[model samples]
Target: METLVKLFKNNIRQYGMIIALVVIMILFEMITGGLLLKPINITNLILQNSYILVLAIGMVLVIITGHIDLSVGSIAAFVGAVAAIMMVDLHWHPVVAVIASLVVGALIGAWQGFWVAYVKIPAFIVTLAGMLLFRGLTMIVLKGQSIAPFPNGFQKISSGFIPDFGSAGTNIVAVLAGILFTVIYIVNELRDRRAQKKYNFEVVSGGLFILKLVVIAAIINAFTFMLAIYAGLPNILILLLVLIIIYSFVMNKTVMGRHIYALGGNEKAADLSGVKTKKVTFWVFVNMGVLAAISGLIFAARLNAATPRAGTNFELDAIAASFIGGASATGGIGTVFGAIIGGLVMGVLNNGMSLIGLGVDWQQGIKGLVLLAAVAFDIYNKKKVTFLK
Candidate 1:
């Protein structure tokens, strides 16, 4: 029992939020007559929140580096508008338009990064200026009008499903994918455990380890079953998975990731230790811009339109997600997986509230309260840790 408590305390940031997510899901499942977890609604939840989730991924990185970006929403909007004009008005190929949009996003990132990193401007002020600048640019580009009916191939970025390679009451592709992923996950976990043991690191008890593997495997299989029953897997889901895997690897197994954390943890100390603080900070913002652009493209693809209001308040959602996912306000503490989980929690909340027929205003209020609670919890945990020390 003491060991369990110790474990919980050590991993409270992760376990706490995961438990909260599960509890919230179960509560909503009961209240909404299981509508919250319906396959179609689940798919819609993924579709609706994918862009915000993408932003959260980038936002978490920015926050970890002890900075904020108020410009991502506008960046998304601007890029979407630009892409629309390229594809619809200029008759540019969809692929070319996407590539161009991403490039534009990178340039925007570079602009902001230059100000923050080289000019030593506070990220808040630089991004705030960018927010207004890009938003106005979005309106100017669209001339305050919305563009629509994107080419089918372009729209597929958000709405397309994976191809069905097997038939099991419509398709077995998702199920197969689920099984494959589960196997990979288990193997990885075991390999990690073996490596830890070989290095004489403390390892969880075998029983506890098995329990975690089982629970995670069950979740993966169940989620994939739901997808298999409905639309196989979304193309956007694939994109998200790829991004998560890539980002997670970068964060966990790469030098740049260490530099980011080091810079965030203590910029002065990192610089003293010979870290390229300016270059790292600059690249982080550039990455954020590229992600924001991708998000914009996805949003535009999903709606089949690019509007002046396309990315309104997206930065807020992403920031909220990053915080709720256990990012420390002071920086140097977060994970790509945590950001994803936080986004899912918000997605589920939105879906559940809408299913229960709640008004948008109420939904916003509830979400704000949830975000506050999450931050409060983080602070409380920090205080406890400090007191213990």
Candidate 2:
């Protein structure tokens, strides 16, 4: 019993958000008469949460380093406007428009990064100013109007799905790809476990490992199966998948990842240890900016147009998701998966509430309480650990 308790205590930080996710799913599932997990709604939940999940992954890194970006929502809105104007108003090709928007976003990130990392400005002030400045720029670019009905090819970025085996031209290819992905995932997990064992580190039990594999396989099959059901996997889904994999790799398996953890753990000590603190901080913001641009493009393509208010309140959702996913408000802690789960929880709440006809007011109230509870938990846990030590 004592061993079990210690194990639970050790994993609480990592698994706490997951527990919250399960609890939220169960609660909303019961309240909504099972609408939360209904097939169509479940699919929609994934789609709605996808962008924020992407943002949260990047945000996790930024927060871990003890900073925040408030301008992402505004940047997304502005970039979407730019893409729309370039495609519709200027007759630029969708491809070119995308490239242009991304460059602009990177530049925006660099600009802010310079201010924060070099000029020694507080993140809150810089980002707060950025929020207002970029939002106003979006209005100027969009002329207080929404532009849409983009070229079909661009529209497909958001609305198009991958073709599957059932389709005349694409089913076999997709099936093979899915199988390959499963194999790769299993191999990687087993390899990582072996490495941990080599270093005499305590890996999770093989039983737990197999359980994870089974659960992952089921999830992948279910996901691909749904795409195969209606319009195969989306082109954007593929893009998002590639991005997630790349970012996850960079975060977990690179020197860049090490630097980020070092900075988050202790900025001054990290600087003294030659981690290039300013450069890392600058790059982190730049990365966030690029991600915001990518998010804007995806959203715009999906809508087949651009709206002036495309990303309003998005920053709030992303920030909340990170915090709820177990990121410390004071920084030095967070993870990609945690942020994803956090975003999904919010998505579920929105979808479930909407499906069950819960008023928007109540939904907001519940979310507020949930956020408060999460932060309170963080503080209480910190205090408990300090006392224990």
lDDT tens digits, residue span 309-375, model 2:
8888888888888888888888777777777777877887788778778898999998888778877
The TM-score of predicted model 2 comes to: 0.93
Q: Give the TM-score of each candidate.
A: 0.98, 0.93
Superposed Cα deviation of residue 180, candidate 2 (Å): 3.6
What are the lDDT figures for the candidates, one per model?
Answer: 0.94, 0.81
Candidate 1, residue 311: the lDDT equals 93
Query: How much is 255 displaced in model 2, in angstroms?
Result: 1.3
Model 1 off-target regions past 4 Å? none
Please list the Cα RMSD from the true structure of every candidate, rounded to 1 decimal place.
1.0, 2.3
Per-residue alpha-carbon lDDT of candidate 1 for residues 37-66, written as tens digits (9 for 90 to 100): 888988899899999999999999999999
Model 1 lDDT, full chain set: 0.94
Q: CA shift at 213, candidate 2, in angstroms?
A: 2.6
